[model samples]
Target: MSEVITGGCLCGAVRYRCTAAPNNVGLCQCERCQRQSGSAFLMATVFARDAVEFERGELKVFAAFDDDGQGLYRHFCPTCGSAVMITLDRYPEIRSIMGGTLDDKSWLKPTYSLWTSSGQPWLVLPPGIRLHPDYPDGAVA
Candidate 1:
């Protein structure tokens, strides 16, 4: 990726710029993701922690405990309650941004699907990508 990726919260209270290309792109089918996003799944792209820049405003972070009892921070705009990004304690170097907030997402390609065990039965994922029953093999479980 030659250019930086830009995004922000719904209320425009927070904005971000990512200089480094995303390390991971995928959809998560975990229940927590669905509950937090109020959707069927979480569509996100992960990048190095330092690659993300909060160019406009501050974000409110909610510490949510995962099924494994690990704490993860869900960062969002307090004004709109729009989830912007996330950081897991186990993966401090990685920050996952909500894809829906991206200013340009014409090149997104989800290479994996996480938590397939909890995915909706009607959801048919593409055949080539890795699909995990619970968590991916190298995932912090």
Candidate 2:
């Protein structure tokens, strides 16, 4: 089995652990993601919600609608102001961990990229990963 992925916020106010290996990892260049991450793009990893647990700190959320008008919830650390995770409020069974929060970033390379149309020219994506101008079919996987 893959070793559990564990991490926390900058101030340790929020901590999380996921027993399931990430089924997908990718970068998102949607405007909201760009703004929230305060960078060129937002990197993310998907895991089953049943596989993740919050050891401490409550998650603070900002509700927003995604491209499909789904109820998207952006969660972060209240103390450190660090982006933590995001999820669809209606489906709590699947969860995403903000890639920036991983304890060991070496293994968190993105395998795909989404919303590339909104991606800035200043940012250069890594070579050899699938790039989707928008969400692909079965994107939830």
Candidate 3:
């Protein structure tokens, strides 16, 4: 089995573990993502919904729709207001963990970047990472 990945909210009020390897690790620079993260972009690591197991505390969720009108749910720590995870109605089988919430982020390497059209002009990405003006042509997320 792959090594278990563990993470939690900034306040330590919510904790979780992932047993499966990530399906995708990407950066999102959409306007909504920028606002949600309060940064240039959000680093998200995706895995199967069943792979993530919450070990402690409850998450407060904010539900909204994307620019395309797809349902989006943002889960966070109510105590510290740290975004922890997100779920999409269009991809119910998948869950995305906010990379910053992970206890160990040394292994987190974003392979793709989305919404480059809305990405911050001053931001620079590492070489060879795929860039998409919007969601990748065949990507489900």
Query: Evaluated with lDDT, which candidate comes out highest?
Result: 3
* Tens-digit lDDT string for candidate 3 (33-139): 99999999988899999999999999999999866898999998999999999899878999999999988888888899999999999999999899999988667
Local error of candidate 3 at residue 71 (angstroms)? 0.5
TM-score of each: 0.92, 0.91, 0.94
* Residue pairs with backbone overlap in model 1: none
The local distance difference test score of each candidate is 0.86, 0.85, 0.91
lDDT by residue (tens digit), candidate 2, 1-141: 349889889999899999889878889888889999999888888888888899999989999975677888899998888999989855667888898898987877688889899999887877998989877776762
* Candidate closer to the true structure by TM-score (higher is better), 1 or 2: 1
Candidate 1 on 23-104: residue-level lDDT in tens? 8798989998888899878887998989999999889888988678988888889899999998988788789999999988
* Candidate 1 TM-score, C-alpha based: 0.92
Better of 2 and 3 by lDDT: 3
Off by over 4 Å in 3: 67-69
After aligning candidate 3 to the native by TM-score, how far in Å is the CA of 113 from where it should be? 0.4
